[model samples]
Target: MQVLTAVPQVLSYVVALVDEVPEAKDVKAGWLAFAIFIGLILAVAFLGFSLVKQLRKAEAAEEAGLYDPSDKKPTPMPTVEPDRKDDTAQNGA
Candidate 1:
């Protein structure tokens, strides 16, 4: 029938239109993903450079006698306690 043929043609046109005009959400999502990937790569490179610089500084300090290994001593970490209110009136005990 002519109706069936017209339906297929309409569907094809719709498909073509949809393919031509992309949605804003899809474009935004792709840009966000690209930005995140680039940011992650930059952060990793910065961290690696920072680590290398710190290592070099430490080595230079050691060579200059800034740190003495023979006189090194271990120190204990301090502990902190949280303060709580004593509810003696509520318990009545």
Candidate 2:
């Protein structure tokens, strides 16, 4: 397309304009950004350590029989005995 072809010329003109401009001020990231960056790194490291610890704990719990296996048959639920009910009250004694 013609637009794509004109992009290089426009970019060259922009580069020339930028080259003519003088540096006004020097900008720095400063200490606050550096502190926040370090804090984030420490947080991520802490989270990674916590994740590994919890995973180890879960594995230990599983080994100690906390988690039941799927292949084994489940225990039957307790049934209510019909004989234990008050028959007279049900019959409007």
Candidate 3:
């Protein structure tokens, strides 16, 4: 009986305490954070889809022989001729 009587008093105190607390004022900040999170998710999804599309295009191009690594040979750099007058002076000609 005493416990039951004390329970109501505790409940009333809790209700009073809750009523005295102030409501949140930064609700807009919470909404902004959620918007930013959703935007980042959308951006990442778009980037992933684009990357896959580019990879598929590249694969198709490779299969069509548009990019043949084995047939590509590196061109040699051109050699520069020395000046004839400079060479003659060095040789004491």
lDDT of 2 by residue, 1-86 (tens): 99999999999999998887645566657899999999999999999999999999998987888887874478999999666677
lDDT of 2: 0.88
User: Model 2 misses residue 22 by how many Å?
Assistant: 7.4
Q: How accurate is candidate 3 locally (lDDT)?
A: 0.87
lDDT (10s digit) by residue, model 1, range 1-93: 999879989999999988877677766557889999999999999999999999999989988899887866668789888886678966886
In candidate 3, where is summed lDDT lowest over 10 consecutive residues?
20-29
Clashes of 2: 0
Poorest 10 consecutive residues by lDDT, candidate 1: 21-30
- Show the lowest summed lDDT stretch of 10 residues, model 2: 20-29
lDDT at 52 for candidate 3?
Answer: 100
RMSD of each: 15.3, 18.9, 19.8
Winner of 1 and 2 under TM-score: 2
TM-score of 3: 0.45
> Candidate 1 overall Cα lDDT vs. reference?
0.87
